[model samples]
Target: MNAKTETPAIPEGACITAKVPERGTALLGDVVVNPYKLAPLTAIIRDGGQAISAAHVRVLGRGERGVDIAYEVSERSLWTYGGIPVFGLYPDHVNQVEVTYKLDGERIRERYQVYAPAVRLPVVANQTAALPLVEPIKVAPGFEHRLYLFNHLLGEIPGGRAFKWNALGGAAEWDQVGNNWIADSNGDVRWYLDIEQIHDSGRRDGLGGTMGFQQTRDGKLIWGQGQTYSKYDLLGRRVWQRALPDKFADFSHEIRETPNGTYLLRVGTSDYRRPDNKRVRSIRDHIIEVNEAGDVLDFWDLNQILDPYRGELLETLGKAAIQLPEGVQKQESTAANELLEGDLPFGDTPGVGTGRNWAHVNAIDYDASDDSIIISARHQGVVKIGRNKEVKWILASPQGWPERLKAKVLTPVNAKGEALAEEGGLYAEGFDWSWTQHTAWLTGKGTLSVFDNGWGRNFSPTKLAGNYSRAVEYRIDEAKGTVEQLWEYGKERGDEWYSPVTSVVEYRADRDTQFIYSASVGFLTPEKLTTTVLNEVKYGTQDVQVELKVSSRQPGSVGYRALVIDLARAFS
Candidate 1:
C-alpha cells in the first residue's frame, strides 16, 4: 500500500493543514530543509460533530527519539492547533509524526514523514590564514582560568569543536571536563559518558553548541542549549530537564542561576496570533524563572514590558512590517505594515529562523541587590526591568527619538564625567549607546559590565569610526535615570577585530589588579556569521592581559560565547 493509503482518513469537517513552511515536504521533493532554520510545523485543525477538546500528538523520528505533544483547545470554537516543533526532529533524518484526536468517543489518527535536512556548512574560500598581530600582555602572576567555548553551529563549521581553552597555556583541551557530555536536540536527551569505556547509541556526534555554560560553586554543570535547559553533576549524570511549554522553545542563548535556587532561562517565544487579524510572528525574548523541579516560577515578558512604547519606538527606530502582540495594541500610532527593517524598533530584520528577528535577546542576568533583571537584547539595546514590571532604565542611542521617548533613556557620558551634546537631552558625547550588545551583568561596584558587540556603532548618527568590540562598564543610576560610562577597553588596535554577535565580559577582582574575561570574539556581517576570538584584559590599565586569536581548525568558524572560570572548580 502507498504511504497515503496506509494512513487513516479523518471525518468530515476535520482537517489538518500545514501552517508554517506553507507546505509539507520540500519543493519538487528536493528535501531542502535548512537545519539551522528548522521551523515548527503547525497543523491547523477543525473538528466537526462533537467538539474536540484535546489531542495527543506522538512523534517518532525514523532514527531518533519519540516526542509526546499535548494540544488543548482555547476559547475558539471547534478548532485546535497541533505542532511538532523543529527541535523534535533529528536533523538530516526523516521523522514519523503521528497525531491522534478523539471525536464522539472514537479515536482518529494522522501520520506524516518529517524530513529534516543535513547541516550544510557555509562556503568559505579561506580555511586557514596567516596570524594577525595579536599583542598579548602579561598576566598578574598566579592568576589563571579555564575558558569554556562551544562552536556556534558545530556541524555548520568545517572543523569547529567545543572545548575548554587553558588560559595559561592558551591551548584547547577537550578532555578536561569529560570526554563525554550530555546534549538535548529537540526533546531527545543524548548521553555520551565514557566513550572508550561505555557506549550509548544516543550520544551526539560532537559536543553540541551552547550559548552559555556554568559550574556552580557546589559542582553542578548547568547548561542551556537549543531549547532545553538541563543540569548535570560532575559525573555526567542528569539532574533535571525542563519540559518547556509548547509554542515557546529554543532557549538558544543564556541561562543563569539565581541566588534563590531558581533558574533564569532566556527563551525565544514566537507566533502569537493577535485578535486584529495580524498573523504576528516574533522571536520575542523571555526570562522565565524555573525552580528545582523544572517548574516555571516567574516570567517577565519583554515584548509586553516594552509594548507601551510602541508608538515612540516606531517613530524613533523607524517603522517596519512588524506585528505586536495583543497586549501592546492598547495605544496606536500611524501603525502600518510597511517599514524598512533597518528602521525597525529593535534593528530586527525578516531573516532566517522564524522569518522575523523581532528582538534577539541573547543574555539575561539577575541582580539580587535590587531584585531587577538585566537583559542584553542584541538587536535593540540593554534593558533593566524592575521587580515591579517597570522598565527601570535603558541604554541605547536616542538619535531619531521623540522628546517623550528620549526622556525614557538614560543620558550617556564619557569616562571623564562629561555629558555629550544632548539631542533631546538623550545624546552622549564620548561614546554612543552600545549597539548589538551582549552578556550584561551587575558588577560588585554597582555598575554594568557588558560585551559591546559594536554592530550599530557604524550606523549611528554620531558614529564611532572603527568597527571594534569593547568590554565596557557602565554605572546606571536608577533614581536619577542617568548612565555614566565608567570605563571601556577597546580601540587600541582600531577595527583590527570586532564581534558583531555572541560575546561576553565578566569582571574579576583580585588582590592587585582588576580584570575582565572577554570571550567569543568574532566579526559579524549582515549575512549572519562570525569569526571568533577570545580576550582577557586588565581593568584600569586597559592592557591586554592574555588573548587567544582564532587558531581554530575551522578557519571561518565561530563560537557563541565564552567564559573564564577556575580550571579546578570547573572540572571538579
Candidate 2:
C-alpha cells in the first residue's frame, strides 16, 4: 500500500449544497454552523417559509462540572424571518441542543448535534496560564441560574530597564488581557468578546482594555477603553465602533447609553491648558456626550467645574504611602512628597502614573429625570451636577473644600432626621460619607447607592487600621441638604473584605437584592495575589444569597468589576 489517507468527518446538518438555500419553504432549510467566524460555538438555523414568533434553545450539560445553558432567541425583526441564532454551546465537544420554536402559529421542536472546537486564549508575556481562572465558592439555591461577567486584567511583569516608579509593582503593571468574559455559577466560561475584532492588538494603553461592559435596551453590548468605544450584538455582529472626537483622548472607566440614544462617555481632554496658559496632558477629568455620528453634543471639564488643586485626600494617602495597595510599602517616599509639595508643572510627575491625576473620576451615571450627571471621583467625592455644569450637591466630607463648593456638601443625618456631629470629617455613629467610592448610581427608589472603598476614612492616617469597604445606600434630601444611611454591608467583615480600589454596587429590582463586587480584595497581601469576590445579598435580611470568587494562577490578576447578566433577558 502506498499510503493510508483518512478523510475528516463531516458534522451533522452541515451545509453541503453548492447553491444558497431559499427562504419561505414549507420546512426548515440548510443549517450553517458558526456562520460568523467570531462566534465559533453559535449556529444559525435558516427558516423555510413560516416566520418564527418565538424560540428557546437549551445546551445540555456534559460532565459533573458542566451545567445546562439555555436562553430564548429574541423575536426582533433581525431574526423573525431570517435565520435563528443559537447560543450556549460547549467548546471542543459534541453538544446536544434542544430547540423549541413557533412558526406560522404552530409549535415545532428539533434536536441538534453540533461540534464546537476548542479555542486557545491568548497568553501574556512571562505568564504560562491563560486569562480568567474563575472559582466558585458558594452557590445558593437558584443562584446557579444566573451568569456573571467579569472585566479581568492580566498582569504582566515589566522587562528590564525599570523606571523610577517601578516600586509600585502591581500599580505600575500594564494589563495584557483585553477582553471581558462571562462565567456561570459553576465556574465554566460561556462567552467572551474578541476585542481584536474592534480594537487593534498593537495599541494597549490607558487601562489596557475595555471597561463599563453593559447591555443596551435593544440587546446590544457596549464598552469603552483607551480611545474608542464599540457596540455589538449577542451573535458577535459589530454594530458600530467609534473613536473619541479629536478634542478628547483616553476614554476610560464608563460609557453608557442615555435615554435619548446618545452616549455619555468618561474621557480625558487633549491639549488641556492651565489657567496660566501652560499646556499639559489631562487624565480622567472630562465627560462628553456624543451622538451616533461621534459628534460631541456636550462636555464637562472638571478642572473648570471643581477645584482641581484641592488634594487634601490625595495628600493624606500620599503621606501614608498607602495609595497603591495596603502592605506594599513605597520604596521611596519622595514620590508622594513631590506631588504634594508644590504646584505640578506642565509635564508628567514622578509619583503620578499619568499626567495630572487630580480628581480621579472613575464612574459616571446619567439622570434623565433632570438631565443631571452623577460621578464618583476617587480623589474627590461623589457629586451630582446639573446640565449647566452647576453643582447640585456633593456627597463628600465638608472639610478642606472651597467655601463655594463646601456649601454644596450634604450634611450627614441620623435616621431620626437629626444632624450627625462631624469631628475631623468623621460623622457620628450611623452615617459617614463615601471615601474613594465607585459606581454612584440612583436606585429605582431614587436613593443613591455607592461602593464605599473606605480608603483614607475620616481622613486620618492613624485610623487606617480600622478601615473597611462596603456597599452603602443613602437617602438624600436635596432640598434639606442632608443624607441619611439607609443600609450597608461588608463593614462587619472588616479588612478581610476590604477592596482598596476598583469595585461596583448594583441594585436588582427584580430580585430585591444587591450585587456587590469587591474587585481588588487581598491586593496588599504579602504574596501580591489578588482575588475578586462577588456577593448577592438579600435587601432586608442582609443575608448573602450567592458568593463567587475569581482567582488566577497568574499573580496580580485583578478584576475591575463584575456584572450579573440575565441571559434570557439580555437575548430576548
lDDT of each: 0.48, 0.70
Expressed as tens digits, the lDDT of each residue in 1-572 for candidate 1 is 01121222233234343222324432111222222121222222333234543344443523322323222222232231122111234445566655555545554455556664432233344533211112223333333222233324322322333333221111121111112222221212212222222211122222223446766665556776444567754334456755455555546567788888887877655454433333343454577887888877778876556532332222122234354443433232222222222233321342211224545677888989789888887655788888887777778765433343456688665655556676543455456567778788876778888888666463443232456777788887777777887777764554555665566777766432333333334333333234344555666566665555443334334455544333233222
TM-score of each: 0.58, 0.83
Model 2 TM-score (2 dp) = 0.83
After superposing all C-alphas onto the true structure, candidate 1 shows an RMSD in angstroms of 20.8
* Among all candidates shown, the one with the greatest TM-score: 2
List residue ranges in candidate 1 displaced over 4 A. Answer: 1-140, 144-151, 155-209, 275-281, 307-355, 399-405, 413-418, 423-429, 458-465, 510-532, 567-572
lDDT of 2: 0.70
lDDT of 2 by residue, 1-572 (tens): 00112111222232122122234332566666666565556677777655775666677766765667766676773263276677666667888876666656566666677787664455544454555567777776667666787886644523332421343221122224454677777777666655545443343333346778887877777888666788876667778877678898767678889888999888776676654445556778889999888889999998778766555677555343223333433222323433443453322221232346767788888898889999998888999999999999999887667667888999889878899887666678768788888899888788988999988787755243556899999998999998999999999988778888889998988678888899887776655467678899998557998888766555666678888876655566
- Best lDDT among the predictions, by candidate number: 2
Cα distance off (Å), candidate 1, residue 186: 36
Where is model 2 more than 4 Å wrong at Cα?
Answer: 1-41, 46-53, 77-82, 102-106, 125-129, 155-176, 199-201, 204-207, 316-355, 461-467
